[model samples]
Target: MDNDISKLKIERQPLLATPRKSRHLGRWIGIGIAVLVVTGIGFSMANRPTSVQLTSVTQAYPSQAITVLNATGYVVAQRKASIASKATGRLEWLGVREGSTVKAGELIARLENADLKANVAQAAANIDVARARLQEARAELQDASRAHDRALDLKQQNFISNAELDQVKARLDRAKATVAGAQSGIGAAAAGTEAAKVAVANTEIRAPFDGVILTKNANVGDVVAPFSSSAEAKAAVVTMADLSTLEVEADVAESSIGKVKVGMPCEIQLDALPDVRLKGVVASQVPSVDRSKATVMFKIRFVEKSDRVLPEMSAKVAFLERELTSHERTPKMAVNPAALAGDGKEATLWQIVDGKLKRVPVQRGEKLGDLQTISGPVKIGDKVISKPTDHLKEGGAAVVAEK
Candidate 1:
């Protein structure tokens, strides 16, 4: 039995010799391996993407390159007037409205003139009555002349006394005076008739010049006074302007007014029609400066007439150094100057393609305002890095910085 027990003790393998490895050592090593894996993941995340500011390629007008001065203005008519009647009366009939075209001496409206017409007719009738009276007096004068002739015959024959012959002569003289008075009355009546006709004509409103009606100030049944300050009575029947004399009135800063001059070429862009650019020339500069705005008025005339251009439209004018050529009038793709990575002929651009960096070669051209024109494989709307740094590399992941 003792020998069997000794063999069992020996089978314990010498108490398993004090273990060289601690039980917690393996746990600590596992923790260290996990920490290394997490650190590697964080390092990879930090290096994956670089934040950058980007700008898009855009189409720019060639005129921007040559623009010497820019100003805001409004379309105005050079020949504008408020059409009113000479006489005060109610507006009985209106033949025009806004946008109606009128010619010189054309009737545009009429006033209530029934009383004037009657006055004209009465004056004409008075003239006729005076003419009839003059005819009656002439007949009487003829009778008196015959009597006087007979009286003279009698006096020569001594058939009547001298006193009787004198009385007959007096009667003939009276008849002559009556005839002269009647003739004078006819002349006065004719003059009155002409005066009445003039009064009647004044009731008819006629256009003094060719123009287009811009506003209807007085409608039918409204009182129109020639010279009135009453609010109830309109001083003008309508407002009109000569569309052929349309012009742009721009306000140039007094400081920059020296840059502008008469006959300087200009390009006009109307806010109503943004795409259409109208050719123009500076017609005049107001000699006086506006005190409130500190600006000088510049009048510009259109070289080409456009039916689309209307009065009172907002406009932008670019006073060019020179007229744009046909090719330069077209729009070209452009970019900011900072987007180019290098100087001189070796300039390059960092383009962002699908969140990755791509190096593109570019040939710089003209300078438009603060932007630089370029010709390259890039198209409009392509996003490119602006102000690239040494850390930016081709084929690297990129992240757009929030503006």
Candidate 2:
């Protein structure tokens, strides 16, 4: 019976919804999918980190080493002299020019000393004549003494009159007086000759100490004088300085003067030779302050002097509590100065943590090379925003730029 019913049937069921309703349902489904797609895109954007360039904080001992102060100065010579002649005369010879080395008592130059030499010669001849006169007077005095003795014997023996004996004694007295005068003349002549010899010696100019000539102010045939009022007159023969006594005279800020002390270890750098780093020590601090500049002068002596170094070259001094080791001189535990913000009294840094920038306060210390010392929430290996911008905010996600 079931087989016969299946053969008789076959009517189609009515559509569940009208064609418009089906269209409406399709439209709503598409709207929901579009909304879901946009929501996913927003979520993805929120999870993304910000794009930023980063710099790493260094870890090194040199940055942490104590740097007491920094000052600008120039290289100077401690023992410098402007050599000049003591008397007015034409320069006949010049032994040293610029960069010539000289020793103490070395003859550097000579003057026109012909007149002085003549004076010396004349004085010597006078001394000889005076001595001859003195000798002749002494011979006469001896003769007079013998004559007076004979006269006394004659008077005692009553062989001669008293008047004649008195006359002989008077003659002896006059001869003795002449001998004394001649002796005095010899002494005066000797003194005059010595004075003339000294005058001749003064015509030769000599070096006061061992040093190298820095400048040749006067040349051969130049007129040298003790005090030069005329432009042509040369006051100094040469400007010389003891190279061994070279020192750096730095001008330290008066406010920071307390940080500097005599014998402090220091590092010296010259502008002419930028690659060299010279070791030095604080030699002294000037007692007075420069009121106009508001600075104090300090001197630094080189530990190992270099032949390349010269006086008057520009230099910089870094005074330290102790000498810096080879490694400590390198950058360590430091960050780029640009990474620091809110400068002056207090400084802040934007240190990255978990891919986000975090504001942290730090104590700014002396500059190490181009990097600065920062004692704050940051540590070695920590990434910091280099050249932080206004868009970079605290706790904001930051993405480090790829090199």
Candidate 3:
């Protein structure tokens, strides 16, 4: 019976069970896979580009560092005039127009003077008539004198009576009086001619000084009157200005007026010619402040004059601490101080090249308004990282942040 029960019971199957070596191999494979995934994630995070902000190294003028004050104004001519005629007449001839250059005493216009010319001619004829009468009177006086001498001799020789000699003397005296009257008439006629000539000269209009005509206030056939209120009568012949006397008239705040002084050096920039920086000096300041604007007006004269500059152009003026030297006038390389990564003595900035960060060594210089002058391999327009942080390794890729 024991032998039959042993035959019905099931035996343990060792072949079907898993082996220890195989389980150990499977566990090690799972562990290896997990380690690989963790390593891959770490490597990807390290290789990813870091986002950064950048600023460009630019060329800046040295004058920006020393600028004390800035003001805006307009160009104006110091010597300007509205030319008008002193005498009233029709403008028969106009010899100049707008933009014409004229010299002092140059004839610019003429008035109708036919009647005046006739008066001069008549006065001249009167003088000639008076002189002819004087000549006749002198001839009579000479004849009377000869006759009187003959009479005196005859009376001395007892050939004539005393009453006859007296009559001859009276005739001679009468001729002398007639000659004096003729001479007086000639002098009066000469004076009349001079007065007529002066009247004729008044018809011509001439320039008062050297200047360029800015506008033609009167044209040919326009009547010019010195004090006329009628619409048809022109008061001015032209408006003119001396271009050489061009100056900048700037207004400064009354509180800041103390910083300005006569003869102080300044830089002028015209809105018309923005890129051109002109040299100037403070010429004068108005004695009183403007009550409405609460500002003081001052004049700035150009050190170097340009023909292109004109009156009434908008301009900006910078009052400098001192005149810039020849070298200082030129622009120099500059960068924002925040981009620098080291102390003043040993400075370094990250410059971007080929989409990667590069550490460039530079020497620090004077501090401009918001930038620091630097001498390095960087040129104008080169982009550099501002406020660099750790993990931004040299030769590492970087992406620029949107402005």
Q: What is candidate 1's lDDT per residue for 102-206, written digit by digit as tens?
A: 999999999999999999899989989999999999999999999999999999999989999999999899999999999999999999989988887888988
Question: Highest TM-score, which number?
Answer: 1
Q: Which pairs clash in the backbone of model 2?
A: 58-333, 60-332, 60-333, 62-328
Candidate with better TM-score, 1 vs 3:
1
How should the candidates be ordered by lDDT, best one leading? 1, 3, 2
* lDDT (0 to 1) per candidate: 0.90, 0.85, 0.89
By TM-score rank, best first, the candidates go: 1, 2, 3
Better of 1 and 2 by TM-score: 1
Q: What is the lDDT of residue 41 in candidate 2?
A: 97
True-vs-predicted CA distance for residue 167, candidate 2, Å? 3.1
TM per candidate comes to 0.76, 0.68, 0.65
Supply the global lDDT for candidate 1.
Answer: 0.90
Residue 161, candidate 2: C-alpha displacement in angstroms: 3.8
Candidate 1 global Cα RMSD = 6.4
* lDDT by residue for model 3 (303-402), tens: 9788889889999999999997888777779998988887866798896678888999999988878888999888888888988886778999888888
Q: Name model 1 segments beyond 4 Å from true.
A: 1-61, 160-166, 339-364, 374-403
